[model samples]
Target: MKAIWGQKMAKVPISWMVLLFMCFWAYMADAEYVKYKDSKQPLNVRIKDLMSQMTLEEKIGQMVQIDRQFASAKVMKKYFIGSIFSGGGSAPAQRASAETWINMVNDFQKGSLSTRLGIPMIYGIDAVHGHNTVYKATIFPHYVGLGATRDPTLVKRIGAATALEVRATGISYVFAPCIAVCRDPRWGRCYESYSEDPKIVQAMTEIISGLQEKKSQLVLNTMWAMVEQPKVSMRTTR
Candidate 1:
């Protein structure tokens, strides 16, 4: 009888261990880390309040945008990169799908959010011409052709559609509006520019209108002024 009682007592620790683990798991599951502030709060005041909570390193980190290939999630976590972009010709991984892109980007964002500041990381892509750069994405005509259509309204409409598709891929920022006077026909990317005229470039900035702004406020890193083409390409065209 004593031996049987000892055996039953041995089972008590195992049962208690299982119960304790379940309770801890339930506590973690119920944990809520996010909270919403009052809409009545001034935008800048809210931003300042949040910014003050962050360290100097985190602030400086927000200023840098690196290619995802170069900056791994671990490195981004260490450096606190404010943004990561998959430049044209960069893919998430082999056999990547739209869902794959979302998973990859969201994973990086999760790492960023895990930081002390909990600032969500922004992902950018060159969605120029209907996200043409991404595989299986709906490709739209370039600005030059769209400019010939002479429909600023249509152009804006396309931009709105592009924004929807781009956002669907779990990326909010787009590097578009390639505003350059491509006078030389030989230029490879001349198609990206609307026209040789600055007026056309000025008109097309209305793509800003097409992109859904959050409550009239442009989200972070909306514009990245790309400089002139590569020197090697320039020499090749010349």
Candidate 2:
């Protein structure tokens, strides 16, 4: 009778342990189903919920755009960088492959998403003419040449092709379609100008529509003179 009683006492604790574990698991499952993670919610509602949960440092991090040379997984996580960019001639190597570019961008993305908020970082590059930074990408004619052709359809096709090449390397934004009216041939970047005439510039804006399919924003370079000095502002506001 003593031996049977001891065995029953041991079984009581085991049953209690199992029940406690199940209760704990139920709580965790409920916690994981947060409103911010629900896709059915409206975008604004989702954004509001996310913003409400983020710390001030995290909100400030989203405003900064870091260059690839200075970017790292640790830095991205620590600062919560919102975007990464590759300037002209800033490829991983002299002729980095498309796969290499994609992998590099993905690594940065992983770092960004590893933070507490898990927000994805936007990747950008100077893919003005094809994926100019990557090897084996199609090298299209310059905007000046394309403008001279006077074919909006061909220009639009080029823009679409450029967007594809940029995406192949995992970049989501492009610095392209430089809409500058070059009044002087001596300017260093005069070749980037589509034409001296405003009409040509207006017509070539169709490229904006082609590039918009990928949710990519066009980097417009507009030079306006001030009374005292020439201020060169690289505006991506549009």
Candidate 3:
């Protein structure tokens, strides 16, 4: 008579099963967070989430921006470039219209979005003198002419106008409000600078504030400033 096989089983520890389930649940929770985070969240929170997903090479790559025409899509995929720039006179082949510029930038942005973190790329241009180099864009008076008018409010209005035209072309960052204390006119970009006096240059911060919307990380650099105001007290010390 063949004896009945009571039970054929492999034993698994209860603690081990519980640990495996916990790990799976935790992984699911993390995946959900990564999928849902986006720009709509608070700026700090969004940035922090993106930071957690980036590698060291990716963070280093973000600091170096390259011209759009020169950027390699393969390298962009590998390096995780955070920003792209179109300095004066750079444009895609076949079409150089404003709409073409927008489309080209959007294409690059799409490639950037394909990376693991899905962060959007920031596009920049020298929108100095009313997006001057691009065809069909407005040509405003250079800083000198505006300064000659000595109307700060008018300057602000011009900045706002420039900002609108720049946005129309689908660009978010502008290398504008060239603030320089020009001691010599021989400099090639002196024309871009507003004044020879430091204070006058300082005043052009208003123009920068106008050109860029509030609370943006879009400022570019050429100079540094140091403010040292001596405090005077007329009241007698007690």
Best by lDDT: 2
Error of 1 at 156 (Å): 1.9
lDDT by residue for model 2 over 169-213, one digit each (tens)? 887777665777777899877777778887776677566666656
For all predicted structures, in order, the TM-scores are: 0.68, 0.77, 0.71
Per-residue lDDT tens digits of candidate 1, residues 1-238?
9999999888787778899999999888667422323357787776877777778899999888888887666767888889887777788776578898888887888788777766778887887788766777778898788767766777777778777778777777777656566788897877877777766655665665676555321232232123232211111111
Off by over 4 Å in 1: 1-40, 184-189, 213-238
TM-score of 2: 0.77
Position 139, candidate 3: lDDT: 83
Candidate 3 lDDT: 0.66
lDDT of 3 by residue, 62-92 (tens): 7778888877556566678888877777767
lDDT of 1: 0.70
Candidate 1 local lDDT, residue 70: 75
Q: Given candidate 1, what's the lDDT at residue 40?
A: 72
Estimate every model's Cα lDDT from 0 to 1: 0.70, 0.76, 0.66
In the predicted model 2, the residue pairs found to clash are: none
